[model samples]
Target chain A: MSEASKSARPDGSNRPAVQLRSAVALLGSFPALAGVDLDVHHNDVALLQGPNGAGKTTLLRLCAGLIGPSSGTAMVLGQDVGSANGRRRVRRSVGLMGHSTALYDDLTVEQNVQFWAAASKAESETVVPALDRTGLAGRLQTVKVSALSAGQRRRTALAVLLCRRPSLWLLDEPHAGLDKDGRELVNGLVLEAKDAGATILIASHDLDWATSVATRRIDVVGGRVVEGTVVEDAVVKGTVVKDADA
Target chain B: MLSDARLIAAKDLRIEASSRVLLTQVLPFGLMVLLLFGFGISPDRQVLGEVPRRSVLEQVSPGLFWITVLFAALLGLGRSFSIEAADGNLDGLRLGGLDPAGIFLGKAAAVIVQLAVLEVIVGVGAILLFGVSLANVGLLAVTIVGATVAIGCAGTLYATLAAGQRVRETLVPLLVLPVLAPVLLGATQATEAALFGPVSDGWPWAGLLGAFALLYIAIGIVAFGSFLEES
Candidate 1:
């Protein structure tokens, strides 16, 4: 295993990597995440499907420790997500790909990845192959991100995430600007990360593509999870109601 | 934390090296300010001719030098944060295992480097254009270093405080300049003593600049996380 994987919880606790109990997050006057209760275990490929302004991005940001819950509990890697110190502890192990590419426009593709790798404390040796995996090998040393198309930018973002080798991937709209080949690449990357013992929570409007590889489907609307809509794999058509007391 | 700061600082410096925006835009802006001051004060030629032109320019160079630093430093600090906003790299940094204080230091250090360059160019422009002779080179150096740190640290803090906002460009200066008045006063007065009076006379003001620098650096390190996560 790569050195980046060493950030996984070393104690090997049986607890789910992510657990939210009535998690509420607010942006200004509106509640982005009204009250979300979710549990995603290690290696679980959970797909979050929601419409616009449905709190999908907020949930992912909360899980990534980029935002804190306004109320109730949200935990990642067994650390409280609402506290500053707790957020810092989980950040090293979690990789988030959001609506923005999170890249330096002035830096070349290679420098962008290497900078992130250094910041993520990943092995420098892993940078080039990560670029190759994302189909950015040719553009690696030559292209500035400002000169790339949106799809190419997305691929470069993926390459940076790949370098981190994070155990938990919180991806918001991971395939938004990608082409057919790029979409396939994202699916492959998700599966690859899962196979490597990573837990993935992806938010996407592309339900068909998202569910294709999802271990479970979580439907979110109006900033709340629809009751009994968390479906497991095997094309199950039933909704298992969660405990009211939970 | 230190390693993370170094990584971020290096990345910013590389970006500046590639774009040359600081050199091509901000540095020229500093020099323009120096020239404008010369023109603005040219009206005083009759009263100033009584003393040597150098002596007259020396009296006012301190204020003009600091004013140039203040405005030019703002351009660099705003650009520093805007680069992070480019790819949500700021959020990326937060999630990449770097603490907020590390980001603060890295960015401030980069700004300090840029401002130090600006200081040098502006300093030379002041000496030649304003006809001011250096009195205490050592004190001037110390004052510039201290004033640069204070501005860099405080400017970075305010830049991030206004990050991701639409009116950030307008807001950053309003938020930073008012807060930096003490720095401006201290730097101006310290530079005056370094230029005209004995170097020892400026030491207390230099101490004030040093204290301000330390205070802002501490505030940045303590508050960067909270301010950064706001977006």
Candidate 2:
């Protein structure tokens, strides 16, 4: 295992990593997330499968403490996502890779990764390894993000996420712009993170790949989680076991 | 919090260095405005009942210089947030767990530096073109520092408020200029006293500018997180 996989593991306790009960989030006057109920345990690689405007991104943002729930309760890493101080505390432990890469175009790949790591208060040593892991160590590291291709930008964003090593990883469309090799790199990183005891919630249209890596599958529809759609993945046996409620 | 502020400030400055938008675009724009004003109010032309167009231009040069700086600061402020709006960098900053107050201070600090540079270049242009002489260099420096800090804090605060909006480019001026009216007036007055005469009269205006800067700084520190969350 690489040193990047040596981050602090989840505690042995059974406390859920994410718990939401009728959590509602609004985008302006419209309810982007109507009401969601979910519970994700530590080390679970959960995939949030949803159609366009189905609120998958909103749910991820809520868990990341970027937005507060308008109604109901949301708890991530033992902090309420609705309170300012709680959200701040939750943010310290969550890593979110949204649709946007969140990169500074004028900054070199190395500078962007280092800035994020430093901002997250992660150790400075983690930066070089993250770049290497994301295949951004050589000449790519010196290139400004604006000069890079779409796949390269995605890799740079991934390097940033790796450097932080947050307890919960929220990735939206993680494989959108990647090539075949790049897609495999993402899957491998997801597995490595899961094995290191990090809980992941990914929203991806690439169903086959996401399902292959996810331990549990969730379907979100109409701004809410489809009841009883949660299923346990038997990737080892290449089958899915539906819940009794389904 | 201070450490985070330093980090964010350094990051912003690095972005500016690489892009050079402020230097190549905004600085030149300010100088052009000064030159245009100089041309419009030719020193040879007389007006205001034989007050001598030269004297008239010199008297109003302080106001013209501050106005030019304000306009340039608007462009600087817009550029500052436009980078964050791009690629959703503001969201990334929020999730980085750095103190919101620190981010506000860092951004405001970067704007202050940029605006200060704009003031220096435009100040020299105004002095040479408008034929104005500085009577009190100390008071002028104090006024520039206070006014620049005030504009930076207020501009940054408003910029974040308008960030991520589709109309951010248009909305920032609408939101900030009205709020910064007092700054425009106070800076112009203090600058006038600094360049022409009566240095004692400028101190009160400079004091007001300083007070406004401190007020906005406190507001930004306390309220920045909320604004950031909304954006």
Candidate 3:
């Protein structure tokens, strides 16, 4: 972790990593997040499970500071994500892996990872280790991303996230398009990140695999967080309440 | 911010180097436009009111050159944002924590570099095909720099606005062309003054170009983040 992120924590260390109260977000006229009240504590591996268009991705995006809430409050990493300036301030400390891998087709796997790491102001030395950890070392690192398979692209994105070493990770369908080994790698990485004191929010449909690593499961239905369950052997305890509107 | 801008610019340039889309496609398209203009305008015909018996093509070369550049720049701008739009790379940049102003400047810088190269190639093509001689190289150089910056800033801003649209390829030119009229006029008039004589006449137009560039750059830096989010 960087000194800047370490210093970004609020005066008290007891603050929740992600706190949303009646938060709502819109995509055009449609409300993707009608009203969501969720709290995820530090070092928690929380899984968000939902059907398509149930606002799982929207909730993740809001936490990542990619989308500001239309109403109510969203605090992530001690920063208010409802305001533009707040979103900008919190963005560096958070990492997101969305539906797209976000890799440049023309750039080599190494170049893509390096560009993102530099953008995040990460240490240059982390780049190679990230590549090796994601199994994109040597000749694969030099190959253009356009030539890579879907699984390779996901691995490259994972390498990018690893290099940043962000405090908060928002992953949407992280296991998609990955082989069995890749899936295990992702689960291992999530566990490693949790052990390293990073908070994670994963939105995935692969429940069997996701549940294995998740400490808590939150169901998102109709743009609201509906039900919560504590996974077996959970470390951190938190509450997930349904929104007032739901 | 400057360091981030440099990183983005270098990344973009590296992508261009690997893709070679500008070299293989857009550059040839620009040269082709100049060639078409050359064929369209009659070489033997003299301007009715000119003193030195200049041909119609030479008299109109400056305007034709700027027009070609404007058309070609649309393609460049489209390519710039299209790359970002593809696979949600723009979102990646935003989430990466790079300052929005830095992204704007970096993208504008990349566009300027590419446009500068296109301008040089098309400028030489215009000179050779239209039989125009350079008289005031300094004024022409200043005009090119200012005009290119103006185009780069405005083009990058508008391109961001149109990015991620289903009709982005068709929408960009519609949004950008009308905004670039002043650049076309300023650059053409300045070039005419540079090529035809009376070098003092071009400085004011060049100043206009510089002002336009500065205004658009400031606006782009302030507004690019919002536009990026919306797109």
Best by lDDT: 3
Interface root mean square deviation per prediction: 0.9, 0.6, 0.7
Task: Evaluate model 1 with DockQ and give the value.
Answer: 0.81
TM-score of each: 0.91, 0.93, 0.94
Between candidates 1 and 3, the DockQ winner = 3
Show where candidate 1 strays beyond 4 Å: A1-12, A227-246, B43-58
Name the candidate, 1 or 2, with the larger DockQ value.
2
Off by over 4 Å in 2: A1-12, A227-246, B46-54
Minimum summed lDDT over a 10-residue window in model 1 chain A is located at A237-246
- Tell me the TM-score of model 1: 0.91
- All candidates: DockQ: 0.81, 0.89, 0.82
Report the lDDT tens digits of candidate 3 across residue range B39-87: 9999999999889889999999999999999999999999999999999
* Chain B TM-score by candidate, in order shown: 0.94, 0.95, 0.98
Ranking by DockQ: 2, 3, 1
Q: Which 10-residue span in candidate 3 chain A carries the lowest summed lDDT?
A: A237-246
Per-residue lDDT of model 2, residues B46-145, tens digit only: 4466433346678788889988998899999999999999998988998888999999999999999989888888888988898887778888888888
lDDT of 2 at A103: 98
What value does the lDDT take at residue A111 in candidate 1? 93
